[model samples]
Target: MLPEVNATRYVTPLREGGSLPGIVEADNHGTYVVKFRGAGQGPKALVAEVISGELARRLDLPVPELAVTHLDPIVARAEPDEEVQELIRASAGANLGMDYLPGALGYDPVAHPVEADLASRTLAFDAFVENVDRSWRNPNLLIWHGDLWLIDHGATLYFHHNWPRAGNVAQRAYKWDDHVLRPYATNLATAGPALAAELTPGLLEEVIALVPDEWLAEFDFPSAEQARAAYLGHLRTRAAAWPAWLPGAAA
Candidate 1:
């Protein structure tokens, strides 16, 4: 489970994405980019964030620290925006917080080229998760201290939105032509298979177990346990058929 922290202050809204996640100061004195559970995408987005971000970290991809944030609606009383205020009030319980990375710059492919190994691994990871947001227009890749970090995983795990047919989409092919790191993923043909092999049942459960039960309860399942089982099954199925969807997968 992610560490729990109480939000002490709401600094400013980051207008980059639709969810309007904001920067916050926590009781632990740590700064974080908090994603509210009341966001338009709902708690499922937060679930995807925890699963994908932490899973990426375990796989050696750079990801900011994720924590379960406790927020009080009163913290936004002075905010002028009605929209922001309503969002704060509705998110009066547990939300998601990611450690704020200071002085990080947006990644520019031409200015910051990645090595083949890292690029291959990154591409493989996205493919395995069925991420659709890592395109050139919205790379979602950041450069902090000369290393690349992946962010905003809410857009991955698309099948969750339609649970009944999730299995149909499990092994669906990943179209990587527009992937931001496609050009540099020279070793994907070799790396993809090796990386897929790493998503064993044990490791999959480790990452899935990190997701909070409250968030899992919102899914269209009989119980939170079933939701977790669904996620496990979907991911395991996709991982097993990686060669069908993974670009440059080896024979």
Candidate 2:
């Protein structure tokens, strides 16, 4: 959805991304790993990731820089023609584009040693607010050059499954008692201010405006302006309700 996503940049397929991933060179002069889905993921998934990633970055989380990208088919065909590779390139920007992380390693919460308690708490807040895309098998958290990076947000909010009619009240009630959320909730208050400041009116508007018009139509989320206001409200409430038990809770 970013206006900056260059459609003409030749996206070269990288052989490695498990499935549906094509690594491409971004205009920003950084290597990007992208996962594309022709008709399966739909544009909304990409939209959610872009929006949320930007939002998280604003919240002072360790999310990597990201953008929406279009893959060039000719470049894709240049590869050896593997099924997954072929599919990934064929599905380019229409489905996904990611800014590649250099010197990063995958991480599990239990195994990570740098215990920045506030970072953990903020990430959990993200799960509660966004109905996150992570799980046990694919936590999607990466350790790049000694820093943690969040990825694979394509499944968060599960909007595609619920959008036509978020009719079920249950759908709105994400279980915050899960392993990740339960541990972090205690620290939400201290982390809340930094996160709150990140969701500034300007930042929210800038991100919402990036949503591609095509994706907006397909996903049927609230209108961009309305969606922006709603997201702000959601963050505000989270900030207000942050628990006082966290480290540096006085913040």
- Candidate with top TM-score is 1
- Supply the global lDDT for candidate 2: 0.56
Candidate 1 colliding pairs? none
Model 1 C-alpha lDDT versus the unseen true structure: 0.91
The window of 10 residues in a row where model 1 has the poorest summed lDDT is: 242-251
Note the residue pairs that clash in candidate 2.
32-100, 69-93, 70-93, 71-93, 104-144, 105-143
- Residues 1-251, model 2: lDDT tens digits: 45345444445555444445666665567666775655356666666677777666666667766766666565555556567545755464454566777677777667765455555555544543455545444567788877767676666545345543433321243444443424434555545455544545566567656766655554445565555455455444443444432233344
Q: List TM-score per model, in order.
A: 0.98, 0.71
Write down the TM-score for model 2.
0.71
lDDT per residue, candidate 1, 1-251, as tens digits? 78999999999899887899999999999999999999999999999999999899998999999999999999998788899999999999999999999999998999999999999999999998888999989999999999998989998898999998998888898888899999999998888888888999888888899988989997698788899899999999888888788886644
* Model 1 lDDT, residue 111, Cα: 96
